[model samples]
Target chain A: MKRNPLVPIVVAAIIAVMLFAGIHSARKNRAARSPSVSGQVHGKDAPDFELQSLEGKNIKLSDFRGKAVLLNFWATWCGPCKIEMPWFVELQKEYGPQGFQIVGVAMDDSSTEDITKFVREMGINYPVLLGKEEVGQSYGGVNALPTSFFIDRDGKLVAREFGLQSRSVFVDHIKEALNQGQPVQAQK
Target chain B: MKRLFLCSLVLLAAAALGQDAPTMKPVVSMAPAPLTTITQGKASQVPLAFRVIRGYHINSNQPKSEFLIPTALKIGATTDIIIGGTDYPEGHDMSFAFAPDEKLNVYTGDFQVDVSVRPLRSVLPGKYMLRGNLKYQACDNAACYPPKQLPVSFEVKIAKAAPAPRKNPAQSPHSHK
Candidate 1:
């Protein structure tokens, strides 16, 4: 007995449909599981929060309301964070008088003493805050370390960087934030 | 009829015998072996060491552009010791499919990166965390794997520097030329 030639074609179509459904479901699942803060947070007000610094002093984001702020989230365990720490320190020293400030939120689970020791070892001059998971979630759930948010003087969020940023990149963003009051062309 | 059947059976047997046979197993094994080691020293200066498994090779710090495997040492921070700069062994030329346009640099076998930690004269003593990334690609004669960024973490004990050594120990023999 010979089988109908159309049987193979029907089987192939059913297999194709099954594959399409499987892929569609997988894409949806991935979208659901992916972190929400992976992309740029441009054109929105930077979320504000308060945390204690390594020195046990209270640090509030609104305290520097009229100044350009660089909110950097880092961890002692993250390699990229260490690389950019010195650069941030240099920028703070170079542009401090121009209404610029850098706040570092450390995601380290270590005690404040340990964090303070690390900051001193790295020679970080910026304020280092102890980051909590709840605070991180409020700021869009950071998935990677060294995520930085650039806030302008008007309290507008300007830019964000996810990984190691060159000194020039930070400098340029700081300059832009400082010049937000002036009528300047937007340069991204 | 019996003779005809016997002759046909003999022809079939001869045809089967003429076919090619599988080759014997070679004597050498090519799988890479696992590597692990521990070294301890003053927080200011800790000796970094690595052991390579037999049969496999890791790319050196300065691998060719085509090869992505980079050997690195991740050192945890110690009290006042400031650790900076990584020194690695040189690597040889290698090839990969991902970047077919270029030849990659890689090391074959075991390698190590020595890090120097300079502690301030009046710094406190304690354990600190030092972390870094090692980007590399593992490959054999037949194929090369994608570049991988392996996170490395190791501990260093902070202590007073040993008195001026009979052997100016600061001079690293494996210094990168």
Candidate 2:
């Protein structure tokens, strides 16, 4: 049949080039998926950090893209934080369908066992991540208990709260955050 | 004598500053407004009264459980004042849902902590603000909240010992009128 040997060589070269391009793009995607804390101010992009989840899995802030994220810093010992915990649970259920998520970062010095117990008793319905001192600083120094940051869908910081706020205040902010950007990307 | 008069003047000045400060929202309120007088080298009992919010109790300074955050009162260290000691009220033993078998020491309702202040002998007699903070972890039947620090302010005046009364010389046969 008169098939040239050079044809096989050319085919292989094309396949090699495509594979290389695909690998390069995948690496870029991973890099962008894990954002690090860089001390960005409000109106700027929210700095991100990776922390251990209550279940021991590593979680990153950038993993929450395409959704309106409520980053709340709290401790089990904080009374005000407990007062707002119920509201966050409700908000997660109400707005999650519309691409809203609550990521709780407990800036606690207590043992993981204590924190886990608190989370269990509260019946929290969202991701509970452990936050360190540097991570707290990245979110613009959450000195007060129950500090929260409202992030827009596009990953921009929108509003921040330092003390106990009424559920109405949170709902209004969530409404504004939900209205931001486009529909969220489907998760795998 | 000049030091005594000058210290009193300083105390008045500090009182004005204290007036300008806004009162904090109280989960526990201090009682009797912490105004006192302490003598140099002599320990004086400064009773600090605290009333906890109804339906809630706070962990005692020496909590029975190692994990429970203990309530504490600490006078900030300064050369102008020396803290002799403090008599914290014994916390009531109680069990919680989290750990029913483990009894934790806690305080409920109104309690008093008698803090002793011994002004350094060198300290001048004047009005001084006893700066301190009370750290406590509050809890109810259902849940335990994070620990909080309430700033403690006590205004104290240190008075100089009065000179011994001189005997009436003219009335005695030892001296002429």
Candidate 3:
């Protein structure tokens, strides 16, 4: 008995659909259990990390728990990151009085001297910490530069933005973070 | 027909997964190179073609900034094959939305690099495989990816050098008698 010519194509399509669904489901399960997976980190607790600041001081993300934090991952070689640096400086000054702080993680492979020179050249006002791969992994593997996460005063992740976004977007997220959580005095 | 169907299914699945994960996609790809033929002791240029994925650009061999990682080709060393200078095409100076005022020297779309190769006269005349790596960092309008190296290889057919010109012998006096 001869089979229909369209049988193979139909069977192949079905198998392809099944395989795609299976892989996607498996990835979803993995992301639920692991913090290193991207696209599934929203609304979760911001991963706390300790890194060295340009002033040769150790800073931890948990130290800023009482203040709303804007954690940004950037690189010196990234042109878009340079553009966002100035805006971040202005945002930090504007929001600092409201108990908001912006933290920069320099995910650069350049030497400390070079990064320090760049930071000085940019006139950055926020604390710029040297980024490590493990810290990046905890935040869902920041494969793209200029990734930012907004944390409320309670240390819950409120929003995350990938790549360079408009200044207004950053402002809106900052306002939301400031309004969402209680201050250290109130918690005490 | 069954084999074709299986291959099509596999490719479709891979495409779907790649779309979901942007990091899994390769930003640059090399085109298949044609085997080059060169005579012994003579230099020949091998042209390699590469294409950057849409919506991305890479720094040229000579980037304007010292901090930028420039795209470069590093060929492996071989005793029989003498590698010479690699020629890179000029980069286009373009500015993106992020940096509208300053232009960065970059390469978009398709680019080519020419490698000079010379086989020693003492080497045998045969096909030799050359291996190398193309190192580059890619970025879009707003974000940059880490630098990556793509493995490269090409075959070169070495030809024998031409025989030296034969010298004419002087005629003997006895031949005239």
DockQ per candidate: 0.02, 0.01, 0.23
Interface RMSD after interface superposition, each candidate: 19.6, 24.0, 5.8
Kindly list the per-residue Cα lDDT of model 1 for residues B1-177, writing each as its tens digit: 775576556545544434332111121112222222212243333444454443334566765422133555555565655676777767666544323444556566546666666656454455544565555544333222234455555554444444554865586667955
Candidate 3, B89-110: lDDT as tens digits: 9999999998999999999999
Indicate the DockQ of the complex predicted as candidate 2: 0.01
**CA lDDT of B49 in candidate 3?**
96
Candidate 2 Cα errors over 4 Å, as ranges? A1-42, A186-188, B1-68, B73-87, B90-177
Pick the lDDT winner.
3
lDDT of 2 by residue, A1-188 (tens): 99899975875565555555555655444332212121233457888789999999999888888899899888876555777898899999999999999999988888899899999899999999988989888765665566778888878887776556678988987887788765566444
Over the full model, what C-alpha lDDT does candidate 2 score relative to the true structure? 0.75
lDDT of each: 0.61, 0.75, 0.87
Residue-level lDDT of model 3, residues A64-112, one tens digit each, is 9889999999988888889989999999999999899999999998999
TM-score between candidate 3 and the true structure: 0.79
Which is the leading candidate under TM-score? 3
User: TM-score of each candidate?
Assistant: 0.43, 0.51, 0.79
Q: By the lDDT metric, which is better: model 1 or model 2?
A: 2
* Per-residue error (Å), model 3, residue B104: 1.6
Question: Which residue segments of model 1 deviate by more than 4 Å?
Answer: A1-40, A181-188, B1-177
